[model samples]
Target: MLAWAGCLGYAAYYSGLDAVAGISAGAVAGNGVHGAVGWLFSTGDELGRAGVYALTLAALSAGSVLLRRHGVRELPGAVVVLGACWLFLDSHIFWPRGVFTMLAFAVGFGLLTVAASRWSGRLTNP
Candidate 1:
């Protein structure tokens, strides 16, 4: 329960950061600074957005360590939240195509569940 809560909390925090970054980028772009909006969303891809990604990674690492102390491996917990975020973003932001998007989200959710389960199992046997 703690693991799930922590992961979800981190996911929400990350999303909030992303939202602020997006708004900042838009404001910058609106001020005639073209090519800057995309940089904020680059995350770890480029040096320009390194600070945001670094902060996010640091938060996740700290959260993972805390979760581990509670007898839960971080991978499954992290995967569950991150995977859901990915599915939500991909379907809504990247491709909002109707039934196909719904199907893709369903499939992705199933896959994420399987992956999280397998990852969680390693904590017991390994």
Candidate 2:
């Protein structure tokens, strides 16, 4: 379940990047009823859709590798999901600039995940 939450977190973060870049990106890469397929290959645009793909793939692969390598267990799925949701929603409006608080929340969310494991009786004690 934590793995899924991790995936969600990665996806949401990328979505936020997409919002910042103002590009369609992979958010709608393969939609059946859309011409957005070409959006990923757009070269005229500075951001270029491939950047999104790269960021997304990097996030997913890195997140999975780091989680598995460190034997990180006991991640609270709710915190992840909620945090991702908040990020996705907040990313929709980047003009006013609120990413600072979001960054703090992300840090807290990471710490919370570890703390959740400890408090849930899985870890001996932090």
Candidate 3:
């Protein structure tokens, strides 16, 4: 999921759409055909593509942390997915442009995921 979003955003950015691809990036984080349409329309023109690289960075970084927290441990799907994104997906945007963004997103989402994991609400505690 995160790899798909990252690759899609990277490709969109390279196509000269600037950051407007973020719309599709956020949209693709979920499921369904709406994301496909959003990716197509957003990348096709100049509208709704702002902050795309940042979106990719956030999704990938946060998703990696979350994957680590989960049980994808046998093969380390996070590393595998990230590596595949860089190798096959051509994630130059992440190396040269979005490294800092990825770091920031990683820290932010890591904390959030931890806090959420520790949370014990009325319903959850029961």
Candidate 4:
């Protein structure tokens, strides 16, 4: 739980402001359908994008805390999905931080899997 919170909190605080700009810049650099749309529509341009990122960060943080408190097993899967989304979205944007964040989330997923396997009788031990 602390790990999840820490990961999300760090991402939210560090990347929150830059995420939108990074995404836009990355999109322009990546040059794809999403990038084109972002460029054309100016979705999340500057402060707007930052706001969205902040809100998303808050949501993720809250979700992580809630999942941990409730002992929900789906938290790991959620983290993986969120990480994948960040990876894909940021890949389009060309942000290095996005790549780093993706890596963090991937590692978290791996850790979660290992932990689950350790606890569950269904897992075969080598």
Q: Give the alpha carbon lDDT tens digit for every residue of 1-43 in model 4.
A: 4445544644554464355456555676676555464553354
**Model 3 lDDT tens row, 82-103:** 4433432323346654565455
lDDT of 1: 0.50
Model 1 — which ten-residue stretch has the worst lDDT? 44-53
Residue pairs with clashing backbones, model 2 = none
Best by TM-score: 1
Q: Worst lDDT window (10 residues) for model 2?
A: 43-52
lDDT of each structure? 0.50, 0.46, 0.48, 0.53
What are the per-residue Cα lDDT tens digits for candidate 1 across 1-28?
5445545654565565456556777788
- lDDT over C-alpha atoms for residue 120 of model 3: 28
Q: What is the number of residue pairs that collide in model 1?
A: 0
lDDT tens per residue, model 2, 56-126: 44444545554554445423433353444444333433434446435644664576566555555667645
What are the runs in model 4 whose C-alpha is more than 4 Å off?
Answer: 1-41, 44-95, 122-126
Superposed model 1: Cα runs more than 4 Å off = 44-86, 92-126
List the pairs of residues colliding in candidate 1.
Answer: none
Instruction: Find the 10 residues in a row with the least total lDDT in model 3.
Output: 84-93
The true-structure Cα RMSD of candidate 1 reads: 9.6
